[model samples]
Target chain A: MEAFTQHTGKIVPLDRANVDTDQIIPKQFLKRVERTGFGQYLFYNWRFDTQGNPDPDFELNQEKYADGSILLSGANFGCGSSREHAPWALLDYGFRVVIAPSFADIFYNNCFKNGILPIRLPEETVNTLFQRVAQEITHTLTVDLEANKMEDHNGFSAEFKVEPYRRYCLLNGLDDIAVTLQKADKISSYEKNLPSYYQVQEKQNL
Target chain B: MKPRTLFEKVWDRHVIDQEEGKPATLYIDLHLVHEVTSPQAFEGLRLNGRKVRRPDLTVATMDHNVPTTNRNLPITDETSAKQMNTLAKNCKEFGIRLYDLDDPGQGIVHVIGPELGLTLPGKTIVCGDSHTSTHGAFGALAFGIGTSEVEHVLATQCLQQLKPQTMEVHVKGTLSPGVTAKDVILAIISEIGTDGATGTVIEYTGEAIRNMSMEERMTVCNMSIEAGARAGMVAPDETTFRYLENRTFVPKGEAFEQAKQLWRQLQTDEGASYDKRVVLDASNIAPQVTWGTSPGMGSAVTDRVPDPDSFQSDAERKSARRALEYMGLKPGTPMSEIPVDRVFIGSCTNSRLEDLRMAAQVVKHRKVAPGVRAMVVPGSQEVKKQAEAEGLHEIFLHAGFEWRESGCSMCLAMNDDVLSEGERCASTSNRNFEGRQGRGGRTHLVSPMMAAAAAVHGHFVDIRNWTFKD
Candidate 1:
């Protein structure tokens, strides 16, 4: 997996809350075990009309939001069933950063694992960013992972917080097992002691 | 220091070590594996050249990818067949025990665990599947972990985790007639926002909880994850002991006595303080149904969808509007007016025998609507066999409902069973997320009786009209 730091990208505002995992990537697309190639099918149900044509009425299909890579969404984004595919689809769809008032617990953790930055901002700050993106279709947001801050050209700025250890992991692309394996020598020593302990238990059973 | 609840007692007991300002190292007693999440973990182990440390503590079963309708020896779908084969190969290589599709014990991991008595009180259980919290009803500290965490546990039967704050949710008073434990939990999540229990381990207590059967308690605890809780638990008492008395894995003679004594101490002391307390009166709760995409966005069956402006906050109003638009529901429309094309009654949440009996009671005399297609899937093969013996299957089929085999069918369209695009279903499953039933399928989460009512009416209907003698 790639390390998640920060990036500046044009804002794509999906002004809705409770955007569920199934909507992020429909169940039909989950047929493939490999995580890649889900981006095209992301939001498959909503992006297209009955005839499989791109629904012009959908927010993401509008011309102004076309090339945007940062998604600004409402509260409780990525709610419902825990499918890691939600973040995989979003990351594959070129969303490096997802700014929302709040996010579902499972989806938020999955985003970090997949090298996607999920930033939780206060409702007021999120609304301001939404307004800015709504007003200026081509507006950009700059996210600085090193400083833990986000800002736009219009002087709108906010500080986002993440757990220090998770931040360290995201910065270095370390997963839970990778971190555990760092103490391989210690684990080896622990394994060496296991035989003697089990030998005593075996004698007791006998 | 304040006295701790049982949740804290179990959590503190399982802490093997801690990293400074990071999650603690938690010792795991049992680890369950299913086909979907284990392949990647096993692959990671292979890449690292490591063997499973404690294969004895691990158990594997195939559930998510197994076809419900056909019990053929070899599954037809190439991708699913490949995944199941990979799981079998990995388990064999790692020296782990596996219950494949044909095994008598083969069933949903949650169902089989309890029936076999593997989910003992005070044990720390971890699984890759989210509903692993279903084990918590036995007073165990069980929660879902990621595939990477699954690998970590395989290498060392432990987890590095942050301790969650504890919340004691008290449900007092007698439940009115027709209100079941499923309704009680739905009411709790509705009252407390879907995220209200975030970062907390909830303990369900009081007279109402103590009176619930083991199966009903499991139903309530199973969906605690849906409310954003790490896990939900109830103190193990005589009711729990009775349920496990004859199970295969339970200790016998002297060991049974010793275990029972320890289990009794798992309850919270009087005046134990929690980080938060939520109180609900059981008499007031009614059957609920999701009128929109999110579970928290639901109201009682009799109520209509609230106008967006009725929300206290602008953000909430916007959320309401967005859910309404996606669900194709109009503001101020009575929830009953919204029509349903299908009804599905099965899932880890409400697929027990009690749920089937509840639905069967409603469908016995009434026929399903002309245009509606309905299905009732048992959560396990054992449940299916038991229901058949009790003649519940006949009642469902007589009411024009399809009776099928087990495997998380239609609750999620992981296998062949699915709702056609643009179909709206009244489901007894936990989530009503957009496209959750199938591509472009709309779902309304309701109780089994309500689903049966909708199947008969061909629309959302109040289940209170169906009278039950007991």
Candidate 2:
């Protein structure tokens, strides 16, 4: 996990709501064991045609948004399925910040774990960003995690909310496993004195 | 002490460690796994040089990618075969129990979790699959986790989770005959759009939910993810206890009695308040079907497709327009008039024996409509055997429906069973997302009876109006 700080990048506007994980990275591409290299398969169905050629109509395929590291999407950006592959694909595809009105619970959490910053703004604010991106294909925004602010090239700036703990983790690149491993003593103690009703196959204890 | 909701009671009890600001590390009683998601997690554990912290508490099964047909033959898809092989090898190496393709108990992760009695009341459950909420019908705190969290749980038997706020969905009145739990959940989703329950765990209560059987309750809880809730739960009762009794993993004798005593108390306390409350009259919910890509784009069988322009929000209207375009339907077209090319009656959402029985009742003596390909893929080998013993498979096969072995089948289209381009299907699956069944496939989410009705009629039909010959 990489620490999230200030970064300015071209904006890619995906003007759809409830953009699910299946669309983010379809089931066919999920067969690989490694998390990297999903960038090529990200949005496989939508970005590619039946002939496997890149679809011209998709925003990401356009020249201006081709190198976008910031994504502005509609509400409920990561809705269906709890696949962390969604975030893996997005991060591998070079998206560092995703701004949406809201996000599905699991995807939002997965983004934090993977070093991608998912920012939730008002629906109208996101709509405005989408409109601005459409008006100017070169639209860029700078996301500052420490400041909890997003600033656009047109002097448009807005603040976003981040749960304090999540912000702390993001700023420090602290994954849950690292945080949990810190409390190893407490976990071991609790396991040792497990309640009788708490079923455990003692023969298989590690 | 505050009057706690069942979610709070179960969640608080499972917390092994908590910090002032970080997510709490809650102990997981059971962790479910399937072929598609577990491979990467197992790899992560290997990379970290970590053994499964609680192999006994975790269970694995091969679903999602196994072919529903030709089970005796080897899997031809190299990727799918490799995923299944990897899971089996990893389970063996990790010393975790697994119900492989040949196991009678092998089924959809969610279905087997309950049927085997591993998903007990008041315990916390986690699975890589979202429908793991199906276990919450037993009064368990269950939710879906990403593969990263899956690895975390496998290595530690605990998950660092932020506590979700609670919502209460109270369904008053009784369901009408021919209306099922699938219809009830679809109605709930329609009332509260897809993201209505975002950041919340929903506790379904009221007379309507209580009147359902354990399988029916599982059907309702299984689709909670469709409504953007982290999970959905129903308080356990005699129905749940009776369902779990004598199961392979459930306690017996005096231990069962003690467990039952604890389960009986798993309910919202008096005057407990929820962050959000939604009330629905179950009697008013009819046989439902989704007309769009999102589960929320559903209406009663009697209603026509909604006009995009009728929506107030631009986002809703745009999505509605896109959905209408994808579904190839006009705004005012009657749902019954929309023809279906295929009918699927299997998935974690509605592939249990109870669901099979309901569909079998509808197709008992009727033939599938001409040009419509209908199939019934049981959730597990056990479910297939039970349905066959009851002669349900004969009924389906005799009615022009293909009765196949258990796997995920067409629910996700990872296997051979999939909808062809421009094909429309009446599916008993949870998701209706674009290409969920296959690329360019349009899925209309419905209940088993409704899907059976569609197969017989070659279009959506209100099960209430369709008379069963049996």
Candidate 3:
């Protein structure tokens, strides 16, 4: 896991909502055990036509939105059946932040685990971002993970909130296992005493 | 402190230790694995020079990436072959039991756990796949975990979990004709926004619930995760006991009698209070269909897409607008008018013998539309064999529908089966996220019979008129 901090990246707009995990990375691409290289197959079905040609009409194919790192999407982004591949594909495809009006519960957690910041902003703020992306295709949005804030160069900014514990984990690149392992000494000590404790409890029950 | 519900009682009994300000350490009784998410966790263990600590507590099977059309051990796709090999190797090294392809016990993880009686009431179960909550229908506390969490449970047989608030959703009255458990859950999700049950444990109790079979209850709880609840449970009753009567892991003879005596007290008391309460009338629910990406963005088959302006709140309106635009559905268009190019009726959500029989009844004398590509993939080999034994497969084949092997085919397209780009499909699987079936492949989530009707009519069609006596 990558430690979270302030990230300034080019803004890429995936304006559509309900971007499910299966679409984020199709099931065919899930054959690889290694999480790497899924970026290439992200949106594989939509990026190509039946003739194996690139669909120029697709949102990602437009030249104006090329090289954008931030994805601005509508509400209920990532709302399908839970597949961690959705966030893996997004992060590998060079997206550092996903700004949406709302996100599915499982997909949102998966995003934080994979080092991608999923920010849930109010609908008005999301609409404003969409309008800005459409008006100035070259506009960029900056996300500060440390401050839990997202801002654009055009003076639009919003604060995103995350749980304190999850925020701590994301900022330090520590997952639940890493956090628990930090108490190895205490865990070992507890294990050593567990047998006697259970024995005493059994005696009391008798 | 509040009085304990069955959920609290189970959680308390399972707690091994508690660290201040951190998640409690609770022992897990069972751990389930599937091909899609286990390979990486096993790799992480190998890299760290660690071993599976409790192989006896763990079980593995293949589902998501397996092709429903083929049952060969060496799958045609190289990547899928490698994944299957890795799972087999991991299970062998760990001494864990595995139900590989062609095994009589092989099926969807959720389906097989109950069928084998591996999922018992009052146990804590964890799987790397969502919809693990389907086991909760048996009065167990089951939830999906991440890969790291899988490793944690593997090494320690315990998980660090924060206690969730409990909510009781009481449904009163009886379901009308043609209504099923799938419709009840869909109606519940639509009523309480998709996130209404977030961060809570929902205990479903009411007259309607007590009347359902174990399979019907599983279908209802399987989708509780869709409502954003950590898990959904029903108190184990005689119905549950009867379902597990002959299963392999269930208690035998005198032990069974003792277990039943204990299970009978799993319900809430009359004066018991919940942190939250929601009441639903089952009489109002209709056969539902999702017109948009989220399950909550659904309406009856006869209803039309609502204009965002009709929403009283700005947030509601914006969400409705986004769902409509992403779904490419025009406002005010009747859902019945939406055309479907394909129909799929198999997934952990509804792909049981009952589901296949219901779909077969609808398609028995009808032919699939000329332009429609319809398929029925059972959730397990056992289900497939049973359906064939009953001649349901022939009914589907004669109706011009493809009857294939068992796997999570087309549900999420982890296999080769998928919808072509820009085609619309009426699917029985959960979730209608944009491009969920395939890229630019529009999906409308419906019941199995509705899917069959759509297959016959080549669009979203109401099956009420085609109803056959059960």
Q: lDDT (0-100) at residue B61 of candidate 3? A: 87
Question: How does the DockQ of candidate 1 come out?
Answer: 0.29
Candidate number of the best DockQ: 2
**In candidate 3, which residue pairs get closer than 3 Å at backbone N, Cα or C atoms, i.e. clash?**
A10-A69
**Number of the top-ranking candidate, with lDDT as the measure:** 2
TM-score, per-candidate, Cα-based:
0.92, 0.98, 0.87
Model 1 ranges with Cα > 4 A deviation: A50-52, A57-67, A182-206, B468-470
**What are the RMSDs of all candidates, in order?**
3.7, 1.9, 5.2
CA displacement after TM-score superposition, residue B302 of candidate 2 (Å): 0.3
Tens digits of lDDT, candidate 3, B191-236: 8867777777889999888888888898888888878787888989
Question: Which regions of candidate 2 deviate over 4 angstroms?
Answer: A192-206
What is the Å distance of residue B270 in model 2 from its true position? 0.3
Ranked candidates, highest lDDT first: 2, 1, 3
- Docking quality class, candidate 1: acceptable
* Model 2, span A9-125: residue lDDT tens: 989999999999989998878777677889998899999988899999998899978899998898999999888889999999999999999999999988998899999999888
**Which docking band does candidate 2 fall into?**
medium
Cα lDDT of model 1 by residue, B199-298, tens digit: 7888999888899888888888888877888889999999999998867667777778878898898999878888989999988887788877777777
Query: For chain B alone, what TM-score does every candidate structure achieve against the true structure?
Result: 0.96, 0.99, 0.96
